[model samples]
Target: MTESVPPRSRPGPRRGLTERAILDAALRLVDAGGAEALSVRSVAAEMGVAPNALYTYFRTKADLVAALGDDLLGRLDLDAALGDADWRSAVVRLAADLRATLLAHPGVVPLLLHAGFAGPRALVAGEVLLELLSRGGLPADDTARASYLLQTYVLGTVALDAAELPPGAARPDDAARTAERRRALGGADPALLPRTAAAADVVAAYNGDAQFRWGLDRLLDGL
Candidate 1:
């Protein structure tokens, strides 16, 4: 019998896979199943490649998470916000944009918190924030403190917003539950908590956007 010739093997993703492509796949996985679903295996599976294929781009899950956070940070319009604006306005615009972006990808908040804003994009954004504060005439120490406060405020607000709901509750039911809780708080003992009882309506009317703006304005004013 004639000897059979061996078939050619398929090329590995080492040739075709890219960091951008891997980050894109990781974002899709997060969008579908949250950040917890992201892994070398899951991302590779999402891209229809072997798990080892991702090693060409990201050596570890932490690297992938950092890449994901940086990718998201790169999406913000910090350049535009920095241009042609007063420092206060620039800061407000940047903070609002950051919050909106975080809300858009709620699943990535934990990753951002864990990664602590290292990476090129995050650094650029930080530089812009500091520039704004410095241009606004804050001294070096004050500028550093303000930047930290702003970063903390933005990240903490987004984290709280993301963690507000338990999984699987319907929106209307959740709204009703929140309303009931507010009502209960409103009805608390006036004798024990006079200010809370007096401002019950204001307390119960907690609009997130309004609250965020109010807090941001107050912080900026203090700076």
Candidate 2:
């Protein structure tokens, strides 16, 4: 049997510029340009409004950035992400999900680090992570410590991943670059840096996801 699709709702009456509109415009600007491009004047220009008009919604650039961070964090579906997974699995999923979310908006990564995780959504995410850790039978102290460790790992990883290259920079070919770097390291005097020379081959194979999972598993093992 075919199920009928519900009718689309009629568009609401147009309201003049709103805080929501301002935020949307700001996000679009950030997505096109990096965080450095984000400014009250830029967002106002994007919205076709005077720079002073944004003051009605956000008094300063900091305020606008705060609202943008909140909006981004609020998009995560904590419950759905965790699902029926066990505590360990849930924590792993949460960490990966947070990374994925931040990676989606690379411009916001710096704001997340600099502005702090004091937003309502960030607070809720923290509570959920703590609850999962506690349920895993970790002691209170361990749970707190684990939460901080996990958050730090995720944030640092995302921040480094999002770090921008200079204008007109071209990335090198991965296989060729890796081989060249490893060969150079391999040729170093064994007596001076024996250990580094020995590990050069293994170190040259850089796999971001594998490295992240390796570290995550080690942390989980410690817990």
Candidate 3:
């Protein structure tokens, strides 16, 4: 006595999509095409599913990006790498490892910059560092501040390392940037600029790895 429902009017396949699978596929997309290529539709296409299906797994794109960031960080096995190393050496190795990973995935560096350190991997890294510092006899306050200082330095270093020229952009060498500024201020003509250009090489040489290590060592010793 009621309108008949068609047999085809049944629930669709609930068999393939899962949160882990979606996140895993999203990670691969990011790794292969870079973070910019990651979108709900792209990931869904990668998984051969409807874009709306991903919404069930990740409420929003930010959630998916954060998940990808956490997965990326979890790849680093800091504890195993540390392996009885002294706290100072362990910290340095951690910094180097983070720098290497971030540099390798330059596309994802922006994700880290925007999100900062909020993922589960970040929390674990912070906790491990805190424990190591505490065991090394640093007071609670100093240990916390040192942790902040170390993380900030590492993030800034990675960000600088990932910098690149924008599209169709011609980045001036140091002397050029400086010369242009000087010219705008009516300080000197192009002739004076050539003389100052030679100084750029000295500045560049002074900012090499040796200088970095020197500063890092001195700072750590004070800590």
Candidate 4:
């Protein structure tokens, strides 16, 4: 979408301008072109409605983004994830579900990066996490701390994955990653840094389900 995008004006208040409809329109724009492509005018153009029509549902582009973030969070099936008998299994299931959501809508990841998902839907997810932590035998303080650790682990991993892999890119930043790895390891010489040299290739590879699970399980084990 261009900066000069023009709104598609509709007569009057554009009957049936529900909040859900407006959110749906915004979500499509974000999914197609990421957060930077989202704007009041751009969404209006996508929805075939005047820019002002969205103001009834969202006060600004920021408002729309937040609502969309919460909407996405609300999509997670907390009960299904928590259905796992053990707390560790439940946490893994919940985190996995969240990761899937973030990967599916890579556009919304930036919204979480900056503004954060602090709305009602976000609160619901938080509540579920806290409950799971509490049930895992953590005291009040440990539960709060564990909640932070688990949430940060999930969000940070997803954010890093989005930045490194991106969407619709083959061999994403392969050269850049190799160059960075070389700089960090300084040749990883087998004679001088044999251990580093042995695992250098592993550290430079792309992360996927196995990597994600490995890190998540380690964090849970530490807890």
Output the number of the lDDT-best candidate: 1
lDDT of 3 by residue, 160-216 (tens): 545552322333344564455544445433377765554554434332344445656
- Give the Cα error of residue 220 in candidate 2, in Å: 1.0
lDDT of 1: 0.80
lDDT of 3 at 186: 54
Clashes of each: 0, 0, 0, 0
RMSD of each: 4.2, 10.3, 6.6, 8.4
lDDT string for model 2 (1-223, tens) is 9999999995542358887898888877776777787899999899887787777678888888888887877776788655646888888878887877777777767766888777687788888888889988999999999999999998887787677433223334447656766876777788998888788876665425556777898999888
Model 3 misplaced regions, further than 4 Å: 1-35, 165-215
RMSD in angstroms, candidate 4?
Answer: 8.4
RMSD of 3: 6.6
Which predicted model would earn the best TM-score?
A: 1
What's the ranking of the predictions by lDDT, best on top?
1, 4, 2, 3
- Model 1 Cα shift for residue 95 (angstroms): 0.4
Worst 10 residues of 2 by lDDT: 164-173
Winner on lDDT (1 vs 4): 1
Q: Judged by lDDT relative to the true structure, which candidate is superior, 1 or 2?
A: 1
Candidate 1's residue-wise lDDT over 28-54, tens digit each? 777666668878899999989888778
Clashing pairs in 2: none
Ranking of all candidate structures by their TM-score, best first? 1, 4, 2, 3
Q: Please report, in order, the local distance difference test score of every candidate based on alpha carbons.
A: 0.80, 0.77, 0.69, 0.78
Candidate 1 lowest-lDDT run of ten? 165-174
